[model samples]
Target: MVSSAAQTPSSSVEQARQEGALQTALALNRLLNPFKIEVKVLGSTAHLRGEVENEVERQLAERVALATRGIETVQNDLKVNAELIEQPLERRAYAQRLEDATLASIIRARLLWSTHTQAASIEVDSREGVVTLRGQVSSAEAKELAGVLASSTEGVYLVNNLISLSAADMARLREEHQELIADPPLSDAWINDKVQTSFLYSRNLDGPNIKVATQDGVVRLSGEVVSSEQKTIAVEVARQIRGVRGVDADMLKVATKVSG
Candidate 1:
């Protein structure tokens, strides 16, 4: 029989969600929430405490905790039940497996550090030496290389590559990028606007600040040219054939007179 707490509340759905989580947590055993794990319920805010077997489990616990009716926020205090200092020698074995999988997925063919390349994008999950790779890659070479790199790493018994090509296929990926200049959809414009805003706000230069403008499809950059490097970068990036158009830089006037 369902408890009274599980019964549908006359309140809003959000309130129901908060109530549901608290009821569920109370029903579960201490091993589930543990002593270190503290759960706080403040209207819609949910705070979580304690640790779990792995990150996946930690996240799962958070989801369960949030199911309660009034939870607004969740603060996770769940530590990864590391095998080193804790009990149950079996946990140590499991930790080693996870560590190995993380290492294998991040290792490149010849790169020394796992972080040097874009390994963070790749998700690694493993049971023993079996590793599962989930993500997208642009090239067949990249796909094949991903597996080989994972297999070559120590402790990886097998690799399951779940990579799929993005919408931009290999043959036209480079060329298709150029079309952003001719007719941009709203999404493209929003992205460009964000980039331009960030660039303008950055404090990396000192002088008569450069000006950047975009119209219809063309980009016009006007300001005192600081250096050949800056001029080259401005022209190339502002009107890159990929997303933007021809660079109209004639309006730019290099400062020829010093301020008195």
Candidate 2:
């Protein structure tokens, strides 16, 4: 999840510094392109290692890493394979496309399981090594966290975060969340409709693969999800629905090896 920049080190100066550096490293992950990027932060400087598609991607990685809060310098040691540079354009493009698609899937799954962001509301798309995030996010912290997650994905060259806030009125949203806890929304029927709708629209959820049933404001999730992450997200989404008194996931089935 996203948060405001760590304050200038105070009494916990050393601790803050360490955390800031780690955060900066995590933010740089989205710049990776088909190769694992390792980040090591030392004070205000970050060391970047691993392989990249080309000099351009390597430079882009460093630039993006520098933009992350709490880092001023980047020590780039990203190596570019010369053999790939000589390959035909179509071949290179095909390889990149395949890698990008895989990267997008992994990133989307991670976001779904993230505690800091609303995975259902965020959409991940990748093309030509650039990742784009679109859809609605509830809070600014989630928005920032989404971007950072995209940056850290494998084979991601550039990230364009365009997830807008769904709620323009944060105060109203906070009140609604509070009110739902105190006095659920409407009735069981209303809650069921909203819960099912949320699942149908989620980016990471396999909607058709799962079933939703509600009675007396109790949500019961059944059927199968591709991953444990999806199962977790499904439960969280149901709970977030207004008027949900309780959620029963015991009936929900998760496959150990889901492939489609």
lDDT of 1: 0.52
Any runs in candidate 2 off by more than 4 Å, and if so which? 1-184, 256-260
lDDT of 1 by residue, 1-260 (tens): 33446645543454555655564563342234322355555445666666565776677777776665455467777688755235535545555654664555344322212111122245666666687777655566556655655664455678898866775454454353345325534344543463254234223322236666666546676777766656665564344222344567787665575689
Tens digits of per-residue lDDT, candidate 2, 1-260, equal: 11226434452465356445554544434434335567666566667787666788778877777876777877888788756544445655555666667678777765654545533467789986689999766688778877866775545678999988755545555554465446534677776776765576556677777788888778899998877888888887677554677899888888877479
Q: What CA RMSD would you report for each candidate? A: 14.2, 19.9
Q: Give me the runs in candidate 1 sitting further than 4 Å from their true place.
A: 1-195, 198-208, 257-260
TM for every model, in the order presented, reads 0.29, 0.35
Deviation (Å) of 47 in candidate 1: 33
Prediction-by-prediction clash tally: 24, 5
Model 2 has an lDDT value of 0.68
